[model samples]
Target: MHVEWRGRIVVDPELHHGEPCIRRTRIPVSVIISSLADGISEEELLEQYPKLTREDIRAALAYGAELLQPKSI
Candidate 1:
C-alpha cells in the first residue's frame, strides 16, 4: 500500500490554523485517523465525509505512519 500522502494532505496557515488537513477540505488528518481508530469503517468515513476518497483515507494512514518514524539528526 504505497500511498502518496503528500499529494493528498495539505498544511495551510490560512486553513484550520495550519493543521494538516485533506487537500481542499477542512478535515484534519488527525480526525480521520481518530475516527478509524475508534472503529469507523472506510465506507462509514466516506459517508461521514463525502469530500474524502478512499485514497485520501489511505493517505492519512500513510502520513500518520510517516510521522512515527524515528527522526535522524
Candidate 2:
C-alpha cells in the first residue's frame, strides 16, 4: 500500500520499511532534508539523485513543515 503525502512524498510499507520517501523512488524525505541542512546545494542534489526534481525537493520540505506543525485538539 502506497500513501501519498504532500503530493510528491509517499509512504509505502513495502518500501524502505515504510519510511516516507519521494514518490516512485527509494530516496527517503529525511535524507533530502538532512542533505540540504548540511549545505548541499539543490543543483548538487539533483546531480546526486537524478530521479529527483526541484518540485520533489520542495515537496519534501513541505512535508517536513507539515509534520512540524502543531495539531489542534
Top-scoring candidate (lDDT): 1
Q: Which lDDT value does model 1 have at 46?
A: 99
Q: How close to the true structure is residue 59 of candidate 2, measured as C-alpha lDDT? A: 84
Give the alpha carbon lDDT tens digit for every residue of 7-66 in model 1.
Answer: 999999999999999999999999999999999999999999999999999999999999
The regions of model 2 sitting more than 4 angstroms off are: 1-5
Give the RMSD in angstroms, all C-alphas superposed, for model 1: 0.9
Pairs in steric clash, model 1: none
Model 2's lDDT to the true fold?
A: 0.90
Worst 10 residues of 2 by lDDT: 1-10
lDDT tens digits, residue span 19-70, model 2: 9999989999999999999999999999999999988898898888878989
List the candidates' TM-scores in order. Answer: 0.94, 0.91
List candidate 1 segments past 4 Å from native. Answer: none
Candidate 2 backbone collisions, by pair = none
